[model samples]
Target: MIHSLVFLNGFEREITVGNALVTSYFKCGCSSFGRQVFDEMLERNVVTWTAIISGLSQNELFEDSLRLFLKMRHGMVEPNFLTYLSSLMACSGLQALGEGRQIHGLVWKLGIQSDLCIESALMDMYSKCGSLEDAWRIFESAVELDEVSMTVILVGFAQNGFEEEAIQFFVKMVKAGTEVDPNMVSAVLGVFGVDTSLGLGKQIHSLVIKRSFGSNRFVGNGLINMYSKCGELQDSIKVFSKMPQRNSVSWNSMIAAFARHGDGFRALQLYEEMRQEGVEPTDVTFLSLLHACSHGGLVDKGMEFLKSMTEVFRISPRTEHYACVVDMLGRAGLLNEAKTFIEGLPMKPDVLICQALLGACSIHGNTEVGKYAAEQLFLLEPDNPVPHVLLANIYSSEGRWKERAWTIKRMKEIGVVKETGMSWIEIDKKVHSFVVEDKMHPQAVIIYGVLAGLFRLMKDEGYKPDKRFILYYLDQDVKHN
Candidate 1:
């Protein structure tokens, strides 16, 4: 109708008609048409300038957006808060930290930092550019920080590994009588979950319950994750059950938690329950289920689930899914089948797939497959020590000492050394970690004395220490030491 009106009215109303067309094109995401209409406009106002700037930024033409900002200034149109906000966003998307700093200078010159929207946009820009320090400075300088500003700061801290700092700020926010929203709790709990601090996680759990935020799905999901990572599978299940509504994340969390605990049957049960509840499983959910099947040696079940993923769920299998299938087959001692499956994958095999085959070969004493896996793994990860060690072990087990020596020599020439494995256990909420023969702990002498006594007791009980458990480089004297 507007186009018809323009045609009926002819060139006398070209500017009016052109502006309408430009606005319509911009709204419909036809930026090229918008640009054409904009170019034909006889006179453009600040609104016209802003429309183009916003349209370019929205389309992610960040460089063009910045160029248009310069053009707006040259045309003597002063930028308002909206203009500055859009430009700052463009700078952030482009990761133009230097340009962002220049924009910050402009904000200061224009005295618009106190403008809430403009300041928030600046904070977002700095944070997104990986400059959290600048983000915090802007946040602190603000006379009145809103929920949006607080969320941004908390997110910045979380992303930067300042978990404790973020939690502290969250506590202060509550103390200041700020209303705690679901988003705030979710953000804080997310950091707690990643830290894997059970005590801290429990404290957050109690707070969520006290604040009556348990019903929030985001909060519930975070609680599930925290409990899972903290090794409290039962607690995770309890929290999951209490959720008023469950999404794919809640189901996946429970599934993965069971897998982590080596309760494959329980994990499978939960997967079935999740399906019965009509929650669609994502790729992550399937990955967790497949991992459980692998660990439990449920080869047929794993293959059935893999088939159902594409046929029943309509989710396309990614490389990760293929890797999981290969790992499952390999772990179950189906070496040839695993190799064939990997070869048939539409995607090229990765080092992890090769390493999985190598691990299986090591277990089955399949020298042929072990040698093949080792060569491929070595090419992919030349600096890693596992493939070399596995190959050398296979040679040593087969009485091929010369071959073992050559493998060790090659490892040394490449400067690859097997990393010593350490085990840790938490007692009284403090973690204690030790490697074999490590004597650095304050109670190392007492621990060694106790271990010697246990060894003697075990020997008297007709138990023998598996010599294979000892490092090859260690002799009798070193073992005693």
Candidate 2:
């Protein structure tokens, strides 16, 4: 109709009309049609350029989005904040950090760094690109922090394993009277994580109810995750039951939580329920199911699910799925079968799968397979100290002093020093950290005395140290010490 009208009115294509049509088509999910109109436009402006770039990005054609942005720049079209925003999103989707950095420099050159949308986009780009420090620096330097920017940085911290810091910032934001948006609330809830105190989870649950976000799908999902991760499976189920709407993520989370808690039967039941309700399972759903089988040692059920995923659901298994299968088999003492499984994998086995087998071998004391897995791991990820250290421990456990010494020598030669073990506990709002053989704490003497007393009590209660568990190369005096 537009083309007919143009023909009837003898109207030359106006840039504004062309831009509006392009945006409309793109927004309506017709990027190809939008491109057709765009190509026909004799006179294009920055709006036209931005429409195509942003549309491509929104449609997940990140490469095309970036290519168009570059072409716009080459055509001498000045980029607006939207153009930079779209380009940065493309970079983020592609994890093109170098290109993203170049765009950051352009933002400075364009003198639009103060624009809130641009600043928020920059923070998001940096966060998604795995530069939390840069994202936090932007957050700190911003004269005004809006809810969006605050949420972005909060999520960034939570995702990067800075849970304590993320929780701290959540407190600060609340104390500062920032309105707790649903995403912010979700981010704070995520900080509860796997070690969340039941008290903390209940507190957040109360907050969710009080804030009237109990019915929000995202908030409900977050609530379920928090409860599940904190080992309150009943509470998680309660939340799931009460949710007004549930998405794939909600179902997946519940399944994963059940699996993680070693309840494969219940997990399978939930999977069946989800299917009965016409909720199609995603790849993550199968992963969780496989994990349940692995943890519960349900090898037959796991094999059935793996087969169903490919044949019935038509979903191809990923490396994580394969790893789960290997773990399941290895944990069952099917060492030869697990090795054959890896060798027959459709694709090359990843380091994670090899590491899984290695860990299982160490647990089952299969030094032969452990050696093979450790060799594969060394080739796959030489920089990682875990494979080498685990292999050395396996050798030591088997009393292979020569192999253990060789492993140690190789580690030293490669400059791969394992970090000293450390553990920490938070008590009464304070964190106390301790390392192996550490004696630096103010109450170290008292702490060690208590530990020694507990050890004595255990011995008196018929506890005996397993001699076979001792490291083979330690002298008797050193072991006693």
Candidate 3:
């Protein structure tokens, strides 16, 4: 009607009307019309460019968004903060860091990088592009730190595998009296990823309720993830039952919660209920289902799920799904079957798949398969010491000290350092971390005394430590010394 009225009124060429048309076309998912309106306009301004660029971005046409933004740059029109933000969003979605950096240079030249939104977007783009150092630089140099920027940087840390730092940053935010917004709440919950962080997660849940984000579906989903990750299945179930609305993630997270808690049958039940409720299952949903089957030792169920994932859902199996199947077979002591499955895969086994098989082989003392897995791992991850260590453990378990020594010797020759084991205890809302044999804590003496007592009890209960693996430790000690 507007198009007709504008034509009737002969206001089609007017700047305001043309801008509206471009924006409206893109907003309505008519990129062709939006482009037609844009191209036909005799004159275009920053708003015109921003409308088309940002509109394309909002529609997830990231490539077109960047292209249009580039076109705008080549023209006489100068992009403002809004245009830069849209381009940044496109870059982030595509992880087009090189293009994003060029845009950053332009924004810096315009002297608008100090703007909070611009800073946050830039940081987000950098973080998503795997440039956490750049993101950190932006965060540190920001003129002011608001909760939104803080949240972005926090998520950046988490996404970049800096979960420990993310948690510490949250602690700093809380101490600084920064209000934990819903987004911040979710990010913090994500970084509280293991059962040890259950205390932290509960505290955040209370905050979520107080802030009235309990009803917010996004926050509700985060709460489910937090509870499930922290091994609070009952809490996750309670949260799921109370959700006002459930998205695909909500259902998937709940299914994964059951999978993680070893209730594979219930995970299957949740999946059926998700289907009954008319929610489409995503790739993650199937991954969760497969994980449930693996842990529940339902081999037939797992294979059926894997088949159904491709045949029924048409979802291509990811490397993780294959890894799950391998882990399942390994757990069930079907070493030969797992080996055959891996061999039949069209793609080369990734480190995840190899690691799973190697771990299983170690448990069952399958030296032959273990050696093959270790060889694959050696080719795949030349630097990762986990395969070397696990393979050596397997050798030691099989009474092959010479082979175990050879494995340790190979590690030394390759300069592959074993990753240090870390442990932590949360007391009085403070997480205290320790390394292997760490004696730096104030209560080191008492801690060691308690550990000694526990060791005696464990030994009495036939829970003896395999001192056979001491070869690797001895080498490690000598290397470090």
Candidate 4:
């Protein structure tokens, strides 16, 4: 009604009314109308642009947001700090590292300083773009460190496989008297895996209750994620049910928890419940739904959801979504169909598709498909040791020792190296790290001797270990071609 009134009165031509209308429309989730109001405006300023750009980003229309930012610059309008911050967020959401770097350069050149929101957005962009080195540099160079910035960088480290680094930094925040924040708790919890997060998550849950943060939607979502990561599906459900409010993230989190716990039917039920409550499912929700179907061996159902995502929700499938469909087929032992699907992609296959196909091929002993997948990986990421290692394993299983030798040899000739794999275990209230192999442990010989005995016994009893789990030590040598 108010929108109609504005249209009837021609009030959208006023700058303040137009800006507020745009921002309010986006906040109310009527983005199409927000866009219409924005386009009808006769005058636009920095605030107007910021409102529209930020609204576009908030509505998950990231590419449009950045396009408008570029257009704004081309029109000789200077973007203020809020504009840059919103643009950085769009870059982060899109994972457009190149554009994000350009924005960073422009910000530095324009002397935008001491704005924590922009600093955090910068860190988020670099981190989400998979450049933790740049994120750390930005964090260190900051003139100030606050709770929000620290939380962003901590999340960067945790999500980018720097779990140990993230944990150490979380300790620093505690020592510096940083108050507990939803983001901080979530990031710290994310630094651990499987059983590692449970104890800390519980402690944090207690702290959240003590501080009256239990009702916070963000924290509630974090708890759901934390419980799911720890494999405590029941606990996650309990938390989800207790929340007085739920957003799309809340629903998606619970659904993902069900998917992670191998309860595809319950995940579907929750998805149904979400839709019945008039809550719209986002791409992440579908990712979980597809994952549930994939792992549950519901290939036909997975295909249906894949179609529904784009058709019903009007979401364009991302690389990850394509990867899931391939994963669905691959996990169901439909190697030929998986390959065909990849061939039919509108875009070139990415690392996720290659990795999924390679793993599936390994499981099913589809040597030809495995070789093709590994070759694609070699071309796409030459320095990556995973394809070389996994392909060599495929060769080893087929008694094609020459091909295996060539694969590993090519890896060495190109100076490719693999990070040392690590595993941990807890027993009798103590944790042990055993990835040191023969290097650091005082009783390495004894441990290996015992392990060898166990393997011998298991083999004698007709038990065989999965060959995919074994990582052979790389011996360096040159290769032909």
State TM-scores per candidate.
Answer: 0.73, 0.88, 0.87, 0.76
* Best by the lDDT measure: 3
For residues 1-481, write the lDDT of model 1, one tens digit per residue. 6656666878524565566676677778888978877877778777777778887888887898888988887777788878888899899788889989988899899888888887788887888888999999989889987878888788888887788799889889888889878788888877864334577677777878888998999899888877787778899889988888988988898898898788999999999899899899998999999889989999999999999999998989877777788778888889889888987887777887888888777766677888988988888899999988888777755767788889899999989988998876656655577887888999998988887787667768876433222253223553433
Query: Residues 1-481, candidate 4, lDDT per residue (tens digit)?
Result: 8878977997757899889889999999888989988888878999999999999999999999999999999986789988999999999999999999999989889878447787889999999999999989889989988888988999899879888688778767767777867778767766656646466567778878888887888888888988898768898999999999999999999999999998999999999999999999899999999999988999999999988998988999999999999998999999989999999999999999999998888777788999899989989998888898888878867768888889888989999997677776555534466673555766777877787677667768876444543343221121110
Whose TM-score is greatest here? 2
lDDT of 2 by residue, 1-481 (tens): 7756865776647888888888888888988988898999999989999999999999888999999898888887888889999999999888888989999999998888878888888888888888999999988889887889989998888877888898888878778888888888887787776544556567767877888989888888888888887668998999999999999999998999899899999999999999999999999999999999999999999999999999999999999999999999998899889999999999998998999999888877789999999989988988888788888778767778788889888989999988786676656545577877778999998988887778677768876554334232212443443
Each prediction's whole-model lDDT (CA): 0.81, 0.85, 0.89, 0.85
Once fitted onto the true fold, the runs of candidate 3 whose alpha carbons sit more than 4 angstroms away are 1-45, 144-146, 461-481
Q: Which residue pairs of candidate 3 clash?
A: none
Query: After best superposition, candidate 1 residue 449: deviation in angstroms?
Result: 2.8
Q: For model 2, where is the 10-residue window of minimal lDDT?
A: 467-476
User: Per-residue error at 166 for model 3, in Å?
Assistant: 2.9
Clashing pairs in 4: none
What ranges in model 4 sit over 4 Å off? 1-112, 115-146, 159-161, 195-197, 273-278, 427-431, 436-438, 442-446, 464-481
Q: What order do candidates take by TM-score, descending?
A: 2, 3, 4, 1
| TM-score for predicted model 2 compared with the true structure | 0.88
